[model samples]
Target: MTRSRAQTRLMLAILGAVFAFLYVPISVLFALSFNEGGLPTAWTGFSTKWYGELLRNADIMGAAWNSLIVAVASTVIATVLGTLLAIGIEMRRRKGRLVETLVFAPMIIPDIVLAIALLSMFSLAGVRMGLHTIIVSHVVFNLAFVCAVVRARLRSFDWSIVEASTDLGAPATVTLRRVILPSLLPAVIAGALLAFTLSIDEFIIAFFTAGAGRSSITLPMQIFAMIRFGVTPEINALATIVMTLSLVMLAISQRLNRGSLPGQ
Candidate 1:
């Protein structure tokens, strides 16, 4: 009994340490976001002034709007194309390893490599890098995630219902709308949210594809530019807001997925 008690205590200690390692820095940053002095070393009471300043900052707001546009456009395109692609892939009786690898390549590829490749492709193709290009680039990677999420939901999906609808004289479009899509809606929404968060946070790809312009700057890019100038109170506030948004989206995605995401 003493030995078992000691083991349990050690396990609890390890768990506590792991939690602290993961969250202590984030907790400190969160606390400093509200610090009136805005310094990590010193706390001069709490304030929400930085958040107000963030809202009033035109450059930040513009970049935020640009990020929103990219995220929304990419999510929408990825969701539709990805859902169809997932359905088509899942319908195949014999899935090949090559096909699977190709489909999942975007998810596994290094961001820097992908960004450089995209930049080269665009340059060779004479495609002007702008918001449209960013949306297109984002869609390429986002679709893989959306497809994976939709495919996970499809694992337990019933094909018979779709067959029955077809036998009952329903059109393919009607069956998809009334039967297949309704069942896949939860995963679809979750995938969209996930894609939105990723696109919003993606920096390297957007930076490479954004080309020469202040017009296409995104929130992540804006944050990077600010950090280069030196960390400010506004950065803490911006970081907090961005992190909170990401957490909220992730929480919603997990809730909607009911714990069954792509890999799990």
Candidate 2:
């Protein structure tokens, strides 16, 4: 009992240290975001002025809108394609190893490598790089994530229901719409939320694919530009908002994909 207790205490200490390492800086940054003077030296009292300033900045708002557009567009496209692809792959009798690798390649590939390759492809094809291109680029990896989630849900799915629906003379489309879709909805939504979060925070791919000009700047890009000039209070506020939004979305994703996520 003494040895077990000692081991447990050591594990708990390690866990606490890990959590502190990960969240302490984030906590400090969040706390500083509310500091009126915007300096780390001392607290100048709590204030929401920086958030108000963020709201009033036209460039920030425009970049936020651009990020929203790209995220939404990419999420929608990826969800549909990924869901269908997952369904199709799951129905196969033999899953090809090479095919599986190809499907998931985007998820594991380095973002900068993918970004450069996409930029090269777009340039070679003479496609105008803009929000549209960014959406397309995001869809490449986003779909892989969606597919993974949906495929997890599919693994435990009862294929016999689909078979029964077909046996009942239900059309393929009808079976899919009525039987398969209902079961997959939670995982689908979870995947889509994850994709949206990734797209919103993604910078490198969007930067490369978004072409020249202030028109295509995303929230991440804008934040990067702001930081280059020096750390300002507005950035703290923006970071707080982005971090809060991402955490909220991630929580929802975890809830929805509770059993479907890997190593759950």
Candidate 3:
């Protein structure tokens, strides 16, 4: 009993240390975001002026709007393509190793390498680099994530229902719309949310593809530019807001994913 108690204490200590290491800096940033002084080194009283400043900053708002557009467009495209790809792969009786590898390549590849490759591809194709390029880049990055999530859900799917529907004289489109899609709705939404979160947070790919202007700059790129000058209270406030949004989306995605699992 004494040894078990000691082990439990050690585990709790380790857990506490891990949490502190991960969150202490974020906690500091969060606190400083509300500081009236707007300085990281010293805290004056609490105030919401920094957040107000963020709202008023045209550059920040424009970048935020750009990010929203990229995220929404990429998530929609990735979700649709990924879902179709997942269904296609799952429907196949012989799932080849090469095909699996290709499907997972985007997720496995380093972000920097993927970003460079995408940039090169766009250049070679003579594509105009702008918000549209960023949207396309994000779609590429997010597609694998969406596919993986939907594929996991599909693993436990009851395909017998689909077969039964087909036997009942339903057309392919009818069966897909009325049967398969309804069952996969939760997972699809979860995948879309997850994709949106990834697209919003993605910086390297967006940066490479965004090309030559403030017009295509995303929120992460803007944050990077601002932090190069120094971490001000406005940056802190912006970070806090972005982090909160990401956490909320991730939490919802996780909940939906859990609920979609068999016998959950």
Candidate 4:
């Protein structure tokens, strides 16, 4: 009984410390966001003025639009390709090490390496750098993530049902449309949300490939620029909201995927 109680106390202490470490900074930022004086030591009163100012900021709005466009386009493209790639790779019993390496290279390779490589390739090919370029570059990494998520869902998926559907005289297209898609929809959705979140948060690659303009600036790029001007209550509000949204979406994605990832 003593050992159990001691262990319980130790676990609670660790958990409490972990939570405080993770949330204290965020709590401070949130409190500062509402401070009427915008000073850490002084709190005149709570106010929503920073959020209102953010709404009125044209530069932030424009950059947000660009980020949305890049995120949506990349997510759509990655979802389709990743889903198909997951199915294709799974169909192969013996995955060549090269194929595995190539498929996952974008995820493992350093961001600067991929960024520079894309820049060089684009310059070499005379591809105009723009939002489209950013979208295309995003897919290189986003697709790998989406593929991994979907592949996990497919890991324990029974193929016998597919065989049965085929034996029942359903054509390949019909079976895929009616049988495969239904089982795969949840995983596909989880992967897509994950992709969208990544595309939205991506910075280094977008910064290099965005081709030097505030016109193609993404939210993270905008936030980075704003940070150079010193942190403001407005930025704190924006950061908090962005972080909250990312965390919520990721939480939902994890819920859908559950313990299926990593072959567990």
Arranged by lDDT with the best first, the candidates are 2, 3, 1, 4
Model 4 CA deviation exceeding 4 Å by range? 1-4, 259-264
Q: Compose the digit string of candidate 3's lDDT tens values, residues 23-85.
A: 999899889999999877787899999999999999999999999999999999999999999
* Candidate 1, 1-264: lDDT as tens digits: 999999999999999999999999888878888999888788999899989999999999999999999999999999999999999899899999998999999999999999999999999999988999999999998999999989999988879999899999999889989999999999999999999999989999999999677899999999999999788989988998999999999999878877444445
Q: What local distance difference test score does each model get? A: 0.92, 0.94, 0.93, 0.90
User: Which residue pairs overlap in candidate 2's backbone?
Assistant: none
lDDT, model 4 = 0.90
lDDT of 4 by residue, 18-64 (tens): 99999999999878888877777778999988888999999999999
Model 3 / residue 260 / CA error / Å:
3.8
Span of ten consecutive residues with least summed lDDT in model 1: 255-264
TM-scores, each model vs. reference: 0.95, 0.97, 0.97, 0.93
lDDT of 1 at 71: 95
Candidate 2 local lDDT, 73-174, one digit each (tens): 999999999999999999999999998999999999999999999999999999998899999999997999999989998988889999999999999999
**Model 3: residues with Cα > 4 Å off, grouped in runs:** 261-263
